[model samples]
Target chain A: MSELTGLTLKAALEGLAAKRFSSEEITTAHLAAIDASSALNAYVVGTPEKALEMARASDARRASGQAGPLDGAPLGIKDLFCTEGVESTAGSMILRGFKPAYESTVTSQLWRDGAVMLGKLNMDEFAMGSSNETSAWGPVVNPWRQQGRNADLTPGGSSGGSAAAVAAELCLAATATDTGGSIRQPAAFTGTVGIKPTYGRCSRWGIVAFASSLDQAGPMARSVEDTAILLRSMAGHDPKDSTSIDAEVPDFASFCGRSVKGLRVGIPREYRVDGMPAEIDALWEQGIAWLKDAGCEIVDVTLPHTKYALPAYYIIAPAEASSNLARYDGMRYGLRVEGDNLTDTYEKSRAQGFGAEVKRRILIGTYVLSAGYYDAYYLKALKVRRRIADNFDQAWQTCDALLTPTAPSAAFALGDKSDDPLAMYLNDIFTVTVNLAGLPGMSVPAGLDAQGLPLGLQLIGRNLDEGTLFSLGSALEKAADFRARPAKWW
Target chain B: MAIDAATVRKVAKLARIAEPESRIEPLANELNGIISWIEQLNEVDTDGVEPMTTSVAMGLPMRDDVVTDGGDPAKVLGNAPRAEKSFFVVPKVVE
Candidate 1:
């Protein structure tokens, strides 16, 4: 039972296919693990009954030889994706107890593939903050503690809960979204593998909106192969999402372990920001060495506008968020805090329902998009976004993919950077560039930092070129052989 | 271009998020800190660059303007915080 929950998604699927273990057994094991994982605050809601029901249906499918690609696999859904009968919170108090009448397209596809929903994982409220502290349910504790210390660390955000759950084996794998570094940064922090596929790779119809142009759904798992497998099942062209790329979903898992000989892996010189830990820089150097050893040629590339990505992201994301979030006006769904008038009701509800960080972003977004400041902040940021994308376009002429350290440093203790918002925004420094460029970016656990916490290496790929990232990431994964797990204290 | 507490108050109102008297100043300070930091974008000369509205290569696909879905008002009102007769109940706006 203990070992059953430890199987990766690929292994679990094969195990189910071979009838080595029924999904009900695996689901039961994971449900028990989730019950014991409350200390980590990984999941905001548990659907044990629903999980069992889905597992039994999966088992019946397998028995009938009608299994799908991900048949009989149990996975955790991020709170942001609405599940038909399950409450999807998006990690905000305002969305409490609001169950969707329909399932998100991505999740509906997962169910179509016979994936089981263990529960909704926590996240930064409305996917805003870099640290999970902004979650209305309270901050999710990083499953990894610094060696021989009792202090808690953040698993990074806004996919913090998904990373922690995957790291702690609370689920086989999880579905996560990225707007600006949400998936990759959290995956880097927790030593899991996560990929934010190319902008149009997956349908965004039902995942709660953050920054529409930047938001994408992807997979987080324990291994490069597992992440690839999950991404294959998670991605496809959807008519519902107008921006969704009308393309075939590649068999991503097959790309893992493929040769990368003569592949140009670019190392962006602009990523070497000041004050980054030496170990992180060293890990990046080691990553380059590993790729070179894997029959790949390393090339230096420059994303000149890289430094502007974070600021640009903060502006554009909040601007879109302000407009996207305007729908929550004490009306159709979720929490409602009444005031004397209709407008007052909206103000009071949003003020009371939203957490501090969310309110902060809303105000920033509002102010930027306001009458006078639109050109100064929002439009300026958009133009910077163009330059940033152009920089990537220039880099692609020289290299097939780019490599850098996933986060500036390993997971920091919660509350360390939360007080200072600018300090907190800096956490996405290494990962934000990928989002701004609307490209696929992935984080693979490559090594551990000095304190023995896991560190990750990021891989950036061109538009619709996630298969190459999977291949390169697998090479890094194989070279590093990062198999360390956080000590099971929870 | 740093904003003051009064600006924050007005912005919050614009955002339809009420800011309490005590919290307004702190929110202002936080917003100013972020805004000032963001002012660095000015250093990048984007004189001729067009704002990137999207990264997807294609324009949004056009579909017939037909009602492909909806009509189950009960389903629409299912998640409403307050509902009556398939209508979402809210504070009265009209006199």
Candidate 2:
């Protein structure tokens, strides 16, 4: 049962489908695991009834020969993704009473593909913080820590709960979104495999928009193969989402093979920033060495505009976030505050509903878009963002894929950089460039730090080339041989 | 790096979030710090650099000029703080 803690999504799905284990049994065990590890704060709300209902439905589907590829697998969904009739607060006080009447396309598709929904996991309020500490619900603890090394380490964010839940074995896999390294960073912190597919690979309809153009929903799982399977089920066109690509959803599972014999991997020279922890630098080198040993060619590539990414992303994402979040005014959706006048109502509603960090971004967002400043800030940022994407396009021509550290360092302690919002923003430095480029990216657990915290190696693929990313990520994961488990859980 | 309290107040008003006088100073200070952090961009010469906006390389699609939406007024206003018959109620702006 303890070893089953590390079972990949592929094994779990096959076991459930073959009746080697029942969905009821799997859900029960995971629920028990979740209950036992409540200290991790991985889950915002647990829905045993929902999980059982979905599991029973999955079993029925299998009995009736309707099992999909994801049949009977248990998955955790981040609170940011609205779950119909379930509390979907996005880890904020503002949405305390909020409930969506419609299911997010990603959540509905997970159930339709026969996966069990364990519950909504915790995250930063409105997905704003690099550390989960900004969550109105409180921070989620990283599972992998040695006794006496530190206390309450972050599982990264704003998808910390999903990563923690999967890392702690509360669920086999979890749904996550990456607007600016939300998915990949948390996966890096918690030692799980997380992928942010091409911008339009997954439908964002009904998802609580953070940064509409940058936000992408993907999966975090125990292995690259597991992540690939979840991505396949999650990807495809949705007429409801105008941005959802109409491209053919490839059999991502088929891409996982031992051979990368002639593949070219580009090591971006600019991503190796000053002050990066030595362990992270070494891990990147080890990852490169592994690829080299695997018969892949390594070449130095330059994304000259890399330094501009973080600043540009901050401006653009918040600008879009401010606009997207404008819908939350006391008029429609989410919490409404009563006031003497309509304007007061919107003011009170937003003030009471949003947390400090959310308000900060909104203000920053509004400032950049303000009159006389729009052209200097927002428009300028947009142009720099394009150059960053162009840099990636130039690199892809020289190599099949790009590689870098998912983050400058492994997970920092809870509240380590929480006081400094700029420090929090800097944590996404390595991951946000992919979002700006609208490229596909994945984080695979590369190695462990001195304290045994997980280190992640990121793989960047060309637009809509998730197949190649998965293949390279899986090949690297096999060679790394890094397996992680939460210290106090079992 | 410190921004003026007045700027913070103005930004708070634009954002529609209430910030007390005591909080305004700290908020302005924080915003200034973040602005300074982002000021790292000034060091890099973006002489001819074009700003990237949307990550999607292709153009955002525009639907045909047809009445495609707008029938669920009730549902839309169901969560409204104050609504009148078929409309959201608001304070009068002018006499």
Candidate 3:
């Protein structure tokens, strides 16, 4: 595990290509590592047999001189992505014993690119909660410790397992979906890199819908280059996913070493929220200084609608979720109940299968979308969402990208905010606005909290401008010098 | 801001979930707390802002409104609790 940590994705692939180590060996090591790190609870289901089979095929392809860029690399699939012949639960019991006959375009594309499948990782049930604690499977523990703090803390969510896996070197990279900060939040918590590309940049054909309007899948990895390597393989249009963009993807790797000199970075004045921890503030200041050192100009900008984003997101996300989830009517790919009547079966199946938090969200979603309440709740939230996007539009005029803290603070204790939904929702405030605006965003570890847990700074780019975001993120990662290894590993 | 037990029960029914009356009070309290917090949005004035339905602004594609999909009814009903050949098996409705 120690040897696996800090190895760049490109280097690892090259090592495999050169036969310095076989893909089978790497896959075996990762499988053993996952077994050893069972206490972390990073995985929901591990498919070592399938991983070895994939690795053997990859090695065979390489021997035949036909290998892809991500050849032989082991990657974890987030439970949210549907894999043909594998159970895709989205972390809910409702989908227990359910198996999809089709693979998500993204998952299959990765397979075509020669990456080995590690297993399905854990997540928040139906991608609803900010902390993985809401998962029917259980919470994922952060591998990093908070100084003398002996108790385990959350790895963040709903893509916590993906982040934790990459951070602990359980896998080189993992697929993660972001509706409102699922990818970036978990990355920040685990001190790794996570990117949420522009909306529609990646296909969502077979990914389970949480909030269809906002959900987008992206890469999580140990370094910016690893993210670029994986993103190139994952991005592009698919006719199966009508929402996926058909635009040509720029060579993202080429931008990694390109100078950030003369780039304009915007600092949103409204992001300096009340009660923000001093450590987070100081880390943000340091990030701004790094941009300044890179010969970039900084200007103050205002997103006046910043405070309204959380409420708007809460309403819109749930409203969409309710509509999308209606497909799972106990007669489809999920739960089914035994009852004397049709309506009773539907009622009983849903009641017995869904967890408390998931049902609460469905209720909230339904309430906001009810016949009499649509205008006041759902429509009004949509209005605010636009204003928030407009705020970004105004700021982009003065800057190429916007800079802020990824979260208010670093990862908190697992049960710290478990009792308070509002407090948990606040953790996503800084990251959600970018999603609402349809822009690209990335999280880079900046420094450590007072208790030594890692803090991260986020960078937001213009829509479809992932190349710029990764370039800036890579440069910042190199300059920040805030490397903190996980406190424990399998 | 305090939602009563009856309101919680009513909302659950509207949402199509069945819950016992005993659990309604706690659900109501939690719902009240969350809704009251969301009420903080009332302080902001968005008088003229247009609602944003999707982050990417584009018109949804419309089809010809003709019937197009129907196949493998048996496969579709395979996961149902009870199905007979190609149709979902619901209790008989008429006497």
Candidate 4:
């Protein structure tokens, strides 16, 4: 029935409702695809039995005329989300065996909407690094390869698995988290559409914490409309998360294909960083042209504090991460190493449990938050963050939304930038500012690079304004018509 | 400022992460590059700027200050690495 696994979330829902296919049929198809595509290393765990059982129950409910919004849809869950009775590792050895008795608010909502859990996707440990290379479970290979090269490229991370799985057709769509481009960067690298909604749009109750202030859950899929539908179910005001905005969850999918006529789209001059690849700069122009063709007035805006965003993000994220990760002391759950005494055991377990990158961040976080350096590093970075957010507030005065390249470049070899942490951090240069500003940002695969790998254009919207971004993204999606799929090699 | 091996050891200790003497210098070198790069934030003149306290312009939403959860110890200690009668077992702190 039209290649069951190839259908988008929107198409799948239509198919399910029309009774062209049962939920069990689609769920089984996704399970088979995931079982065969292990080379991507996308999923940390696969729940075939659970998925089929849910699909059967979904079918029964649909037959009774009580279908939920996402009924019968098989989707991947990020390992960071605590699924009741399922192992939630957040891609670290420290939490290798930890399973939560409770479920994350986001996942619970997905299940309530009748979405099937195919499995838990992999991610960067504690969502620290830009690339998924920092994952203790090993790196997730990008499904898209360079034109003729056999070198393994990374699916941009900390939501690497989610992006790879979506691109490779392992599932309909996957849940993702963005703290400094975890969702967008990976989506850009994999030719998928992902949105990092405004901070506090989604409840952060049961997801593993990375940066408390910046972390937000969002959806990633092959199409903007799919992300829109998934985000509607994922986002809501949860009394569980204090920072969650107490606002009504709007019908996000209805915003897709909305007119962008007379909408002023901003192109920040500061985003034209020196030495950016010519193709990416060209792509930014192409996106602007497409939006202009869609009747959007293009305006050049300035964000003076743009360059300081990554630097400030590096400081603030790690500082919060160090605090969040301190709970993994080998006592409550996960791995434990014996030592001479309690403190020694704590130290030994942490040292052995954490990877090299995780340790580096923790040490940096500890140092910045330490007694002497707090004012110099952490406090100053916070001031810089305020300036960065102010930059967005000023831009919004002149434009409805801003457009830029999602990532600096297309996917690179897995080991290309992993060795140099700075090089890896630079991958999020285009994405970090949105998180710092607490704005909604989206990545839509607009075109391919010279190497035949897909590149994406990012849309930055004002806070609580993801609907406009969705409309703009759909316009770009229609104009560019980026329907290219990575060749099936895995 | 370049992070020294001594500072690395000190930070590691404060972080409660054990670092071997041999790994300290390498870790320091690795951290120094990142710290130096991040020090660029100092270039922005924020003399009177307030530190960003929250991402969104919203106050923390408060619920009724009653205990909403707990009372199930099995669920609480369900994933613990070592638990005894609902208590987490750890290395003895007292001699």
- Expressed as tens digits, the lDDT of each residue in A222-291 for candidate 1 is 9999999989888998989999999988899899999999999999999999999999999999999999
TM-score, structure 4 vs. true:
0.99
Candidate 2 displacement at residue A343 in angstroms: 1.9
Q: Write the per-residue lDDT of candidate 4 for residues A14-59, one digit (tens) a residue.
A: 9999999999999999999998988899999898999999999999
Candidate order by lDDT, decreasing, is: 1, 4, 2, 3
State fnat for each of the candidate structures. 0.97, 0.61, 0.53, 0.97
Better of 3 and 4 by lDDT: 4
lDDT of 3 by residue, A216-262 (tens): 99999988888988988889977666667778987787778689999
Q: Best to worst by DockQ, what's the order? A: 1, 4, 2, 3
Clashing residue pairs in candidate 1 are none
* Candidate 3 lDDT for residue A388: 87
Chain A TM-score, structure 3: 0.98
TM-score per candidate, in order? 0.99, 0.95, 0.95, 0.99
Candidate 3 TM-score to native: 0.95
* Interface root mean square deviation per prediction: 0.8, 2.2, 2.1, 0.9
Off by over 4 Å in 2: A1-5, B43-50, B62-95
Off by over 4 Å in 1: none
Cα deviation of A105, candidate 2, in Å: 1.1
In candidate 1 the C-alpha lDDT for residue A24 amounts to 97
